[model samples]
Target: MSNDRVGFSQPQPEPDRQALGERLKEAREYMGLKQEDVAKVLGIPRSALSNIEAGVRKVDAIELARLAKLYQRPVAWFTGEDPEATSEVAKEVAHVARAAATLSQQDRQELARFANFLKSRAKAKATPDGR
Candidate 1:
């Protein structure tokens, strides 16, 4: 008689934002720090860390750097800016862009108009001095 378990699950094709969130949470927990402890380590509030871990809030570069220092992890761990993530998102974006590039001149003009609108909206949300 023997007891064994083995099977290769199909790989997930998309970025798992939720699992990524949980992985960050688990890493924090493994460091033996509660949310408040992590907040204190980064000199922020518990609510901030809680919101971040819950994926309700986005993290900026500085905050990402602080988290990296506190967690004793490399900055790439938080930014997902490592080679792997960069290559993955880049490839997907390139795929979409190349397909769009085949559009006619008028279609490209309309797309540019929409992209400009989005850019303006993003700028409006920036700091007064303009980030």
Candidate 2:
């Protein structure tokens, strides 16, 4: 997803796979873990662990959750999918408001639509039962 969709004020593109991989690696390293340690915790091989960090292998949702637990971080921390992503997009909105002196009617309508969509998604994710 683009930064615009997520509320990035700068409105840049989303962080790419390499950036994600680096983030994952950094998180793991910060925990003082070896690749093999993580792999063992996930019951996967060390090579598979390397593959995941390299972004050659796509981690499933379960593995993502497991990784989050293993690293003692929220899943959003792992995916970079957080309120900050939305905040980044929001910053751009304020800039647009200031520069344009007013949001055009059409842009305001579009913003309303997108914001509603964002709200529903947040609701879905925030359900108590882990739906």
Candidate 3:
């Protein structure tokens, strides 16, 4: 056999770093958190945070996770895996889910019933005759 390598060796391109930075910046702004405050929480310098937001530096997994927690977002949000990251309703649902996790089974059942009732009310309002 000839001594030749026959395999795809090119590494895949990384995700858009600038877009990631912009999303991080947007999340911070949405939470009304200043960069210095967020940086302090992450135990990094403000300039480091600035560089991260500007896409001049990369954010590692730990830093991203910390930012997610600080911003009340899922880690998937920063990674662009969550399509509903920017949706207010989705955020509310996530918040509710987190709260539900701590509830007793009976409480969860009541919450589900309450949600169904609200859905029925909304559906009734949508009818032409407000049925």
Q: Could you estimate the TM-score for every candidate?
A: 0.44, 0.50, 0.56
lDDT, candidate 1, 4-87, per-residue tens = 434333223234444445656866765556887778877888887776776655666787777677765666755565656446
lDDT of 2: 0.71
Better of 1 and 2 by lDDT: 2
Superposing every Cα of model 1 onto the true structure, what RMSD results? 17.1
Using TM-score as the measure, which candidate wins? 3
Better by TM-score, candidate 3 or 2: 3
Compared with the true structure, all predictions reach lDDT values of 0.66, 0.71, 0.82
Q: For residues 1-131, could you state the per-residue lDDT of candidate 2 as single tens digits?
A: 66555545432223465455676787687656799899988999998778677766678888888888887667785677775743766468546545443567788788778888988888889998645
Off by over 4 Å in 3: 1-15, 88-131
lDDT ranking of the models: 3, 2, 1
Q: Residue-wise lDDT of candidate 3 within 1-131, one digit each (tens)?
A: 55354653323324577778888998887665799999999999999998788776889999998898888788888778888766898778757876886788899999999999999999999999988
Error (Å) of candidate 2 at residue 52 is 0.7
Clashes of each: 0, 7, 0
Q: Which candidate has the top score in lDDT?
A: 3
lDDT of 1: 0.66
